[model samples]
Target chain A: MIEFRMPSLGADMEAGTLREWKVKPGDTVERGDIIADVETMKGIIEIEVFDAGVVEQLLVKEDEKVPVGTVMALIRPAGETAAPKPAERHVYETFKSIVNVKEEIPPVPAPAHEGLRASPLARRIAAENHLDLTTVQGSGEGGAITREDVEKAIAERDIRLKPRPAEPAPTPAASTENIRMAVAAAMSKSNREIPHYYLETSIDMSKALAWLAGANRQRPVAKRLLPVVLLIKATAKALREFPDLNAVWENGLQRKAEINIGFVISLRTGGLIVPAIRNADKKSPDDLMETLTDLIPRARALKLRSSELSESTITLTSLGDDGADAVFGVIYPPQVAIVGFGGIREQPVAENGLIGVRPVLRATLAGDHRATDGLTGSRFLAALQQLLQQPETL
Target chain B: MTEADIKTTIFQLLKRIAPDTEPSTLGPTDNIRDTLGIDSFDALQFIIALNEKLGIEIPEQDYGKTGTLEQLIAYIKTKER
Candidate 1:
């Protein structure tokens, strides 16, 4: 029996609440089939199964907050027979002991709080903040105090108990705070663990932008291509020449075949998610724009698929039209490099002994020093610039 | 579809695409993007919905002409004719 555990969606996700299971015992699941909806710091992420098998048992119940790597279910592989009940129990107990035995034992509901119906996440958050559960009111189904309720109480307490400082207050929204915490943890881990080398180049985007404008003039607004699409396409094309930069570094540098470029999209509410446009190099500029247009809305709505969340080989972040001229990004863990595109601006350009005003974009590369060198990164940038110069090709 | 029928269908489609948007607040001259806060992606979905529901092929070039409620209705009406 193969143990299906709660996956670490990102570096920061420690535990997740299983919101709902899409499958049950005896249901056959494919490798990439979404088996459950897991609520993490990222939001409701559809969890995909990696193994093709018949689910033998569902170990965790819906709405239980389980730590990362906690076994959520047992799957019997296609050829393998169902293990006898006694033997399965023996294996399960041994496995649980091997992987945090204490977590395997569910928290027994306290007798004093017999009628209290708090979510596991709420309980954990309440304990962390030293809040009394009885005093806090529940807004969830049947008077259950959710994570949001605990966070609300914490925010209120902070305002009432302490003298206000001049500093801007952090967002009191529980989900937003959770997202910020997750991002912070991931960024911290990335900074601590990854030795990063940064390189940047300003590419004259005059030709690319001109071409895009001309192209867009011909198409309807709905079918028009954005400048960002060209940037993504160029970046993906450049990865072909500098494959080392398009890789994930675990034990060693592992090169990915498909050039899936994850674009960092900031949400309107706050926080950001990097969902990839798969096989970006293979797609035309128009196709990439269509994909991006579809992606951004769904991403903001928190409706991204499991593969979209997990399959990025490299990341590209473009600060929209009003952003700063340059951005040095932190590399998301697993992926070795992150490409940042600052806002395109009209700048003075001197080319072939002639100085003229041209639209330019600042492209910065933050690469894992362990996986690639500065020379490799520079070459990648050169290719990207060359591709942008030849906009038609992209 | 009649002009009134087209308007109702478009409203239904818009509601489906952006349920939170108040249809009554929108006017003929109001820009859908500005009024509804719908982005290019949402607009593309809207176009797709129109195509599926009305069986009209809106060329990419004409997308610019369909920004307002009046513009969209006129564009669809012209295409249908």
Candidate 2:
């Protein structure tokens, strides 16, 4: 039996509430099937199972928040015979003790004023009326207080106290604050743990941009490629030569087998998410663009699959459109390196005695010093520059 | 299709690509990216959606021409004819 644990979606995610189960006990699941929806501060993400098996048991119930690596379910591997009853009992007893150990470590108690299950609107209404949320009865799902409940409470209170004018309700700020905290925790951990080495290079993109314009002129807008696509492709291609940069630094450097490039996309609300473009090196420019177009929408909507969230071998961040001259990204942990691209701008260039204004892009690499040195990072950047120069090949 | 019909169709397409956009606030001359806050990816999806819906192919060279709602509608109207 293989235990399916709650996979860490990102460095920031410590725990996730198992919102819903797409599969039940005794259900046969295939690899890549979304087995559950996990609610994190980011949003509800569909968690995909990596192993194909029959779900032997559901260890964690829906709506229970579990820490990363906590076993959520047990899967019986396909073609494996059921264990004898006595053997099963022995396994169950061991599992029970493991769970008991977890239970022994008491969780941080919720604050007195914050533990009540009240909606933001309800909380606001109760606060405006000087009503305590714990005293207000909830009528919504999971016995959470709704706006109607607050209104009902207000109506009952109005009979005893003088009616006051209702103030405009405060907007919900929990999600934004939560995201900020998550980002803070992750960045702090990265800074404290990872010994980072930063490298930056300016690449002349006049040829690449010109080539792109000419190439795009022939294709329909739907099939048109962007410079970012080329950047991703070049980065992926370069990783093949400098595999050290495309690795995670745990106790030792663990080089990733596939080149999965994570692209950081900033959400409209607040914060950002790095979702991977799986097997980016294998995709054509058109295919990469299509995947990117599809990925961005789903990512913003919080509909990204678990694999997209977790399977990045290295990260690529671009502030090109945002007009940043350069970016030095904090390496997301486990993943040792992050490549950043700045806006392409026309700059004076002297090439072999010829001087002209050309579009230049600043690319930066932040790698774990333990995993790779500056020479390796520089070589990777050099390869990337060469790839961008030959845009047709990308 | 009439210009009004084209505009309506474009709005529907934009709504699909950017569901968070408030249609009431959108103006004819407003830049979709600036007004609706959609990135280049969403912009490409919008172009793809228009192509699929109207059976018209928009060249990448004309991307600048379709910056505003009015420009996009006008471009589509001309293409439909």
Candidate 3:
């Protein structure tokens, strides 16, 4: 039997509420199959299972909030005839819970005759919000209370207590503010702990844009590539050479082999999310453009998968089109470096003989000083510049 | 498609790209991107959606010709023939 647990979606996620289950007992599941939708601070993310088996039991019910690493289910390996019975499974779960104190055991419901029949989730939320269970109306089978019942009670109570007019049911602004707060907490933690060193360089983008324009002239709008794709590929290729900068700082530097670049996509509402384009170095510019185009809309809608949010080795931020001349970013925690690209601008440049106007891009690197120094950052920038100058090679 | 049909379809596609914007508020001759506050990515998305909805390929050079609602309708009408 294998245990399926809640995954840590990012450094910011502490716990996630099991919004819905896509699998049930006796259903066969393969690796990478989405098993549940989990609602975290980041939003509802489709959680993928990493084990191939028949699901034996679901320990947590829908709407139950559980911490990271809390086992939500057990999977019986394929071709197993005799799965654990309910009695044996109960003993096993009891033993496991004894060993893992953080795993919250559901409160045993009272006998139906006495009072207050509610699911464990309803009870927990009521206790947390200081709501009286006696006042809540049950909406489940046999009038058993569920999480939705308690939530409705809370909303009604809020409406009653407040003197203002009726507020909308779904508060997009409130959720946006929650995202902003989460971002603030992560960035503050990054600022507090990471010892950051900054580096910047200006690269002339005349050759790159010329190549892109000539190349795009033949392709349709849907298939044409963006300059950001070239930047991402160049950054990933540069990281292949400068291994020190493409690492995460745990207790020490943990260098990653795959170049997963977390490209930051800002939402129109307010905050931003960085989702990884996995194995960016291995992908051609066309593939990079396709992946980026697919990710941007999903990222804006807060519909990213858990792996895409969690697996980035390095972060890349580009101020596209309308932003300032340069961007010195803060290094995200665990990530040792962040690469930033400023908007491409037309400026006077001294070429071989005379000064002329050329499109210039200012690229910045924020590196964790504990993992790498300024020299390593400088070389990485140089490599990025060299790669961009020959866009056909990328 | 007639001009009215093309205009409605274009507004619907723009609504998909920028879900928060009110497409009916846009004027006929106003710049679609700047008035809607959509960036280059969104502009590209709008173009792709137009192709999917109208079954027409918009070239890079013709992007300037389709800058407003009236112009986009006219461009799509010409292509519809």
* Estimated TM-score for each candidate: 0.60, 0.66, 0.67
- Please give the distance, in angstroms, between residue A338's alpha carbon in candidate 1 and its true position after superposition: 0.8
- Across residues A1-394, which tens digit of lDDT does each residue of candidate 1 receive? 5567676644455777778999999999887787888776665667666567788778777776777766577777766664522221112221211110001222222224568788888887876654556657889999988999989987875553342233222233655666676667667767878899999999999889889879976875457676789999999999999999988886799999999998888754567778889999999998898798788878766667866877889999988565789999998887899999998899999989999999889999999999999999999999899999999988
* Stretches of model 2 off by over 4 angstroms after superposition: A1-39, A42-62, A65-181, A320-322, B1-4, B55-57, B70-81
Fnat, model 3, is: 0.31
Task: Tell me which of candidates 1 and 3 scores higher on DockQ.
Answer: 3
Worst 10 residues of 2 chain B by lDDT: B17-26
Cα displacement (angstroms), candidate 2, residue A8, comes to: 11
lDDT of 3 by residue, A52-100 (tens): 6798878767776777655577777666668433211121221112100
User: Which is the leading candidate under DockQ?
Assistant: 3
- State the lDDT of candidate 1 residue by residue for B1-81, as single tens digits: 898999999889988877657765789999887788665456667887887899876766577899899998999999988
Give the top-scoring candidate (TM-score): 3
Q: C-alpha displacement of A65 in model 2, angstroms?
A: 5.0
Off by over 4 Å in 1: A1-15, A19-39, A43-59, A66-178, B1-81
Candidates 1 and 2 compared: the better one by DockQ is 2
